[model samples]
Target: MKMDYVSSGIGKTDFLQLRKLYPLFVFSRVSWENRLDHLYIEYEFWTGKNSRNALFFRPSLKVYGRPIEKGSAEWLDPFLFQLGLIELISYWKATCSPEILIQAGSLAASQIKWWQKLYLKGLGEFFFRNGIERDYPGILHIECDSAKQFRPVEIFSLQGNLIPVGGGKDSFLTLEWMKEEKENNLCFLLNPIKAQWDTLRYFSYPLDQVIVVERQIDSLLLGLNKKGFLNGHTPFSALLAFLGTMLMALYKIKNYVASQESSANHPTVPSESINHQYSKSYEFERDFQKFLADSLCPSFSYFSLLRPLSEIQIARLISEIPGALSVFQSCNKNRHCGGWCGHCAKCLFSFLIFRPFVEAQKISGIFGSDLLEKQSLFSLFLSLCGKAEQRPFECLGTEEESLAAASLLWHKAKATGKKPPVLIEKLFSQYPHLLMTRNAIQATYDLVNTEHSLPKKFLSLLQKNVIKKALFDD
Candidate 1:
């Protein structure tokens, strides 16, 4: 379809009216089906005039042996707009569409504010990476049918905790905590990969315990990217947040616990709002909770279980969980087959953080090779440590965490009168300031982050069940 609106650098006389001419995209329809005990969700999006696209479920959703009443789940009727809005942003931002027309469902005044914040701040990394300047077209003009509400389920009567897993150590640690309530702790995943399956199986969770959905993207959007329509990263976690709510309602689950951590708050670029993990940050979690409370069911709750902890702290906690050494995988590049390429930023960061908590041989064995011995990874390590020109755009812990891990490893080796790993020694030699004493090294391991949305009960659970005797208590 030809773009009817003026674009930047076009020197057109209609620049001022660009917002009006720009196509208004609407999330038009949401259809579903239950075949062979599987639920399938289909979405339709329209972009001004006659242009429209559709997305379907690649693999039908499975909620094994669970009772999901069609009428009760269909109450998701009103919230479909919330789910659609999240899905629409990915395609809308692709064209950098100036206006979004909502024809499918309603958005409250607070909903408008929440979405604007998500689109602008959540896409911070996308715009900066694509060289798109920050000029947000005003607040979304949300046009919907009417505000609708359905019968609310009793909040106290809800049964289980829906823990979303990504085959990472953070989720694994969350799993360990939720195990006390494991019978009532259900796992939620979108498009489960081999790594996810392996991790779940290693934890002895039966196939029936996990709920899986296959989210299909519109192929037309992929084609546009090939044809040079603007494209970059979309806030994927935001999409998951909405999809998670739908599944929670459908399956009659209450708590939506993701594994986002405190380290995600750091900006990817210095002095800028471009954080790769913006959707996973504590700010987004807090905003999402408020929006859920205001606009959705009173029975539902959403928050990250690992919000108060750091990557290093989580790594230390994961070390205590059995089978963690071999089953967990955090390398996004090789997540499909559960293999670590051992060259990417995620792999390097995981290697550094794990070094402080686990034995050298065990850590190397889990990764299938010693990452520290590979001199070729030095540059990648530097990128993670903030020595390079840019922070790796991948999801990683803060640079301070990386430096602290290196410092601890070096000092620990010195205290034991043993030579440190090649990477640790090289890091210490190059940046002498990273060389710390045993006392300072211990301080780095204690990550007490106060900026989290975890409730008092959840915080108490972590302290009594996981933290007190886990890391520093030793």
Candidate 2:
């Protein structure tokens, strides 16, 4: 018999928890943003009235059949050294759609199904919405089935530990928390970096010894171009699973710790995405946790360390902790010449969130630029302060933050020449017109003068917390 079909487009997601949405179609005019060529994606899944052994998959996506230079962003001369966004795009297309355009086996897109969605919605609202700074709306149209199609994933306990790392907030907080709990004897994964470990140095993590996984997907990527195999999102979970398997095969430590922030629970909005943010949702976390358990040999565990903190809270923690803000760079697309390259949305949000703790001058210095020249940045940021047509999981702060940053910008504009930063001058031109910006400044100042609510969240997850005791009991 043919498989029963269930699918949908994800609309304004309930931040943190994974709720179900059917018939979801995420459409975006990305070319307007000058980011890429215009394209769209559609995702579908199936779960029948009966079938315990249901298959998890993504329908194939056939995008960019030609060169990106020919209006296919796929071929736009790659980032200075980075690899491919198409790898992610193609992965999403094939795994959810019925088509089989790409041959990159199961990545994280498997969670774009029904079982995962319901599971997360069942959990209390302990999730983060989309945190990327994209101006796209998620329109997931859900199609439900009454019969059972839940393919339970087996959890494998392992004898090995996986330490996920990058040069950013999640890994830094995770490593610190783990070490404080005396779980220093875990494994570490580094994706063939050109520099020394980024987050590890932040907390002065003791390094008597540890397990490490270094991937070499670069040449494999270029070589696989003729057919142009698109790799879905990093099987970050799978990578950890393989680490657990390696531990079983080698050292035998199954405690793999994923440093993904709780904020990652906020899904990403894809331009032309028919469905959005499937991999990072809470449902994915829970189901994949089980999938790893079921598929692995035995004794493996993967869990996010920052499940309790918001992005702002996470940023607050990073600031209080030394060395984190000083050396991390999180942008993927940029024309920057120095540090943090404050052009990408990541850098902009990081600076905005840090407004309370660090002065603007210090932040610009850290990112290796002065605010005097970032006219377009202030424009994009000011836009967020106003009401959004679709309130997404924006990385931008509230009215308080926008005003605080704007106050600083206004002061700087007083000294700036009458050029394109006219918006800067406009801030003070009519106070009532920029009500949101004004309110944001007042809120920011009030909060700052008050007890400061940012770092409190991290303090709960610190060394003294009772749950933390079990996390580091190595």
Candidate 3:
């Protein structure tokens, strides 16, 4: 089943008692899958010694019918332990349980501070959304008992990259840029969807190159959520980062490349730090890299390939790629429909961001309608353009980026002596100064803030392989 399946559950008061009674959350054992073609993982979480919750997370990889390598038990143990920690972190978000107890797994003293920062800062938006005040002391605490000392694992040196596809344009751009290395590259997804499959098919790789992992959240958490537990957003990108670390130890893959763009660095709110994409931000990425090097295996590298590119640039680059126009779907609400719902912030933002690059008809074709033409969506357009006070809590570019795209398109239409699109015309009328006047749009497009942890070795290769050479024009 798809991960986004929503079920109707009894809504009750926020279960404040559960948090008060069970102040500690524990990371327990991992049930490793030794099956022929499955990479199954089951993790256990505990509120106390007796109260427990367990969930199954599996990403099935066929490995092209190859036999399992021998003598992996020793090195794989620590990786599995860390994977269990990552899984436990997400489950802990359900209740915001103050103390995280790792009875067996160990982290360095400094590493503990790093994990604490991730949990608190990453959950800032969650706290804000649930109206849960975080002004109390001892709210985010972690206890780690060293089970084993850290030891360096031998690098896999497989001459391959492991790319996690998220069924979005950003990942598609990353996949396209890395196409030359496709012979040595592998793709994986947690809970494979049609858009992901369509992207994989577009690349025409051997079926064995793709790995699918099904991540199942425990029903107990959902039941508790239904019972009105403190339910809100968790930093899923951080969870993905941990999963990548686990896969590196298991498969010995050299690089874990994700597709988080630089735009994610912007907060969901203008002046505050509450961001829905906190895990995808450069701060979290840098911190994760440091923790990985100091605590986990240094032989493996994790980084985002699209770190330097803005959302506008990414949208433009994706437009140049073939086949993704119809296959790609980033709308979280319209997943069952297999494309844009035309009603949510994601759909509106994506439609607006791509207008300057992709043809109007083709963009409309992808979404089944011209989103700019929808008058009912004017309020959402206002919010996306920063005219409204509340920014939509979704993975969108900054207000300036959206406004710049709208302005650039308006000028482009005027240059051709054609009337602007409905949304563009409306936005131009209200915020005329927001439009890019006298090459200002070019400046924003060229402003690639250098706040990323991309390795120096891959920089030149990324510049050369990107769909648009202008990606490096800055």
lDDT of each: 0.72, 0.39, 0.73
Tens-digit per-residue lDDT, 1-474, candidate 1: 123323434233132233343456666666665666676666677554334332221212233435464565556665555777777776776455566666565666667777887888888887776655656445245556544433334433565788888877888888878777788777877778876777778777876678876777777767655545556777888888877777777767778888898888888986777889999988888888777776767678888878877787777777777778687788988977777888898988998888877888888888878898889988888888778899889899998888878877776777689998887788778988766555555565565778876767778877775443322222
Higher-lDDT candidate of 1 and 2: 1
Q: Identify the runs in model 2 with alpha carbons over 4 angstroms from their true place.
A: 1-161, 194-196, 202-208, 218-250, 267-277, 297-299, 334-338, 371-373, 382-474
Candidate 3 on 242-316: residue-level lDDT in tens?
776666565667889988888899888656578889999988888887777766777778888889888888787
Ordered from best to worst lDDT, the candidate numbers read 3, 1, 2
- The number of residue pairs in model 3 that clash at the backbone is 3
Ranking by TM-score: 3, 1, 2
How well does each candidate superpose onto the true structure, as a TM-score?
A: 0.87, 0.51, 0.90
lDDT of 2 at 428: 44
- lDDT tens string, model 2, 236-276? 44334333333333334445555553444432333323122
Alpha-carbon runs more than 4 Å astray in model 3: 1-16, 48-67, 145-152, 156-158, 465-474
